[model samples]
Target: METVRIRNPGMYWDIAANLHFPPNFDASKHYPAVVSNHPISSCKEQTSGNIYGAALAKAGFVVIVPDASFQGGSGGEPRWIEDPEQRVKDYRDVIDYLQSLPYVDADRIGILGICGGGGYSIKTAIIDKRIKALVSITGVNFGRLMREGFSNFDPVGALEAMAVQRSAENAGASQRIDIFLPASVEQGKAAGITDIDVLEATDYYRNRCPAEGSGTRMLFSHAAPAMAWDAFAFAETLLTQPMMVVVGDKPGGFGAYRDGMEIYGRAASKNKQMVVVEGWSHYDLYDHPVPTGVALERVVPFLVQHLGEAAVSRVTKPAA
Candidate 1:
């Protein structure tokens, strides 16, 4: 377990990353690599992404966990600005670094994105052919989520509001917006929880995954309301790479999973798969044990199959 700080030219900032290598690492052989992106508002140290990175490293691949642009150890101004374009570029910049490493097999690079990151990862795979495999867990299509709030996908008013905010933001006026927190668990107020999904998200965010360093708060204030609008668009025509979209069967994620599947199904790629875990909710797939296990089982095998035996074997070999 070692942490390395890498500078991202794409975002013009430094990214704090954790690179976990198997107990035995060999410099002579190039290892397959997987870059794991964390959830929104989370740093690389979050248990969910860390657990997955450790799991992949144990399976013989060198896992790199890079802190997303505006949060964690990464550099960005006006923290939590939620720029989808910059987020995707951050992953690309990480890939660029991975390719430059002598011990990494450039052709066997893959990615795993969780929660909000899942959408970014999907967008990355669609645009960057360099990525050989992708797995999105409990994914959220930022565009859809923002346009149509949870349980509904209506962008009419949200889009208009964004336009209004964009104007205010351009004019250097600080916009006033509501900040939803897990502590505000009084029905219909949690940040990412939906009526359809389990109601435990409030507890999960407040108690289980409290933010570390800087502030332990779970929500943000006035986070560039325009970010949601910039996160997604009609990207159906851009994806041509293999992708694996995994979502819990519960209500919180059903809509998102369906949306992702729709995108995956229409992709021109010859290889794509969608897996839904029965009796699982969106938050359940975050750091929750049951959903995480189900996710890892599907993801590890998928990467192996798509990236090829040679790549997996190379990464898994015992260090001399």
Candidate 2:
């Protein structure tokens, strides 16, 4: 794997990405490629690049795991803002970069997104016909999650608070940031957080996996765009590409399980599948060997079926 910087044409920022090539990759031959989007507030070096990207490369696909703009090593102002629109646009920018390489087969490109990245991937596929296949692993629909998932905060009230914060920032106030996950499992327990996903998130972000430039916070003002955006908006008609949605059995406040089921039912694609890993929770799919392995086992074949496999790929089609 090699680190590369891709220029985002729409936003004029450099997206830092880790490009993974299949073993004994041949530049003389074109190969199928996959763009893997890391979870929000996280960087490529975490589960997306270090795990999924590397695994997909080993399975014979060129994989690029990119840190979303405004976070990690990517360039953007007022860093760590989770703008859903910009996130969707960044996928296209990554695809543009992939198309520029001679060894990449532009027509066979696929997208894999996890957590918040999964939601953005759905949104990106709706409008970008260039994306031939879509994979969402434990994906959350951020807008819905913000609106209905939280137990304490009123969604409208939260939006109103965000509006005020944005105004304050415009009037020379310091940028207000919001914590993405609890600092520790103990803190989460004290806060009455009983959701398995939240507890696992704290452990995952704080202990199990941590990477430089990956933070536990995001710009509080990011709520404005994120609250209004629907990752599955118009997916029934626009998302016709061959798709696959994977999620764990444990349902949590984030709504990834619900979102995955909804997308699978609503997608227009005649060729689509959904997989539920029985014993795992949402975070378990991130890096845990068993759940992650199950996901890759299913996803790699689906991708191979849609986007023609590389010369080195030995993955077979799923049983009908």
Candidate 3:
């Protein structure tokens, strides 16, 4: 396991990235690399990104995990701001850095995005032809989520609400955001898990993965409205690359996972696959070992088959 710091020349954000290679990495071999995107409000240290990187490294593929802009050690003003356009650019920026490396197979690059990062990854693949393959894990269609509340798809109403929130934010007023967990576990029970999957989500954010460096309480006042905009307008037309969508069977009612499958099904690329792990909940795909292994098993082979053997060696080799 090796950590590398990369500066995004285009965005001017200094990104902290981790690269995991197999025990026998050879400088002479050019390896295929998979760039893994972290979930919303998550840094590279989170279970979803690092666990996947470790799995891919063991599978003989170079895995690059980057801290999303405005989160963790990555640079950005107005911390926790979520901009669809900028997020997609961040993905491209990571690709640019990867392609510049001597050990990377430029043509065999792949991407894997978990949770909110999944949506950004899909959007990036649409515009960037350099991405040869994609994998979205329990991803969200952030655009739709912002425009419509969970279990409802009222574009007009959602946008109207966003407009109100944006107005307050622009007026220098603090905006209210969903608090997935309360200050105490007792309060969490009363809040009800309907708005959130308590068993999976609450446990991790509150007890498991709290923001420490900047402190995890990061929430965006303006970015919530930006999500209401249609980030996937070109989803059907732009993405022609091979894709894999993974989801948990339990608590699968979350609209984003279904939307991901719909997006993949409609993609211009003919090669695509969808997998659902039985009894797994949405957050289970992140920190828990069960869903993590299930996800890696599918993801590793997908990249190997698409990116080929030369690219795999780079991940397995030790750095010089």
Q: Highest lDDT: which candidate?
A: 2
Q: Residue by residue across 32-67, what tens digits does model 3's lDDT show? A: 888888876677777545678778877877778888
Error of 2 at 195 (Å): 1.2
Order of models, best lDDT first = 2, 3, 1
Q: How many backbone clashes does candidate 3 have?
A: 9
Error of 1 at 51 (Å): 2.3
Residues 18-131, model 1: lDDT tens digits: 887865787667788889887665667765346788888887787888887666777876565666677788889889988887778999999888777788888888778899
- Minimum summed lDDT over a 10-residue window in model 3 is located at 213-222
> Comparing 1 and 2 by lDDT, which wins?
2
Which runs in model 1 stand beyond 4 Å of their true positions?
8-11, 150-178, 184-198, 213-237, 309-320
Q: Model 2: per-residue lDDT, tens digit, 1-320?
A: 88999884456789899999999998877889999999888899988888889998998899999888889999988898888898888888999999998888888899999999999998899899999999999998877877776414478888888889899999999999888688899999999989888899999989999788897677887567777778888888989999999999988878789889998999898889999999898999999999999999999889889888685333345999
Give the Cα lDDT of each candidate. Answer: 0.69, 0.87, 0.73
Give residue 174's lDDT in candidate 2 (0 to 100). 93
Deviation in angstroms for 293 in model 1?
1.5
Evaluate residue 88 in candidate 1 and report its C-alpha lDDT on the 0 to 100 scale.
87
TM-score of each: 0.81, 0.94, 0.85
Candidate 2: C-alpha RMSD after superposition: 5.1
Rank order (by TM-score, best first): 2, 3, 1
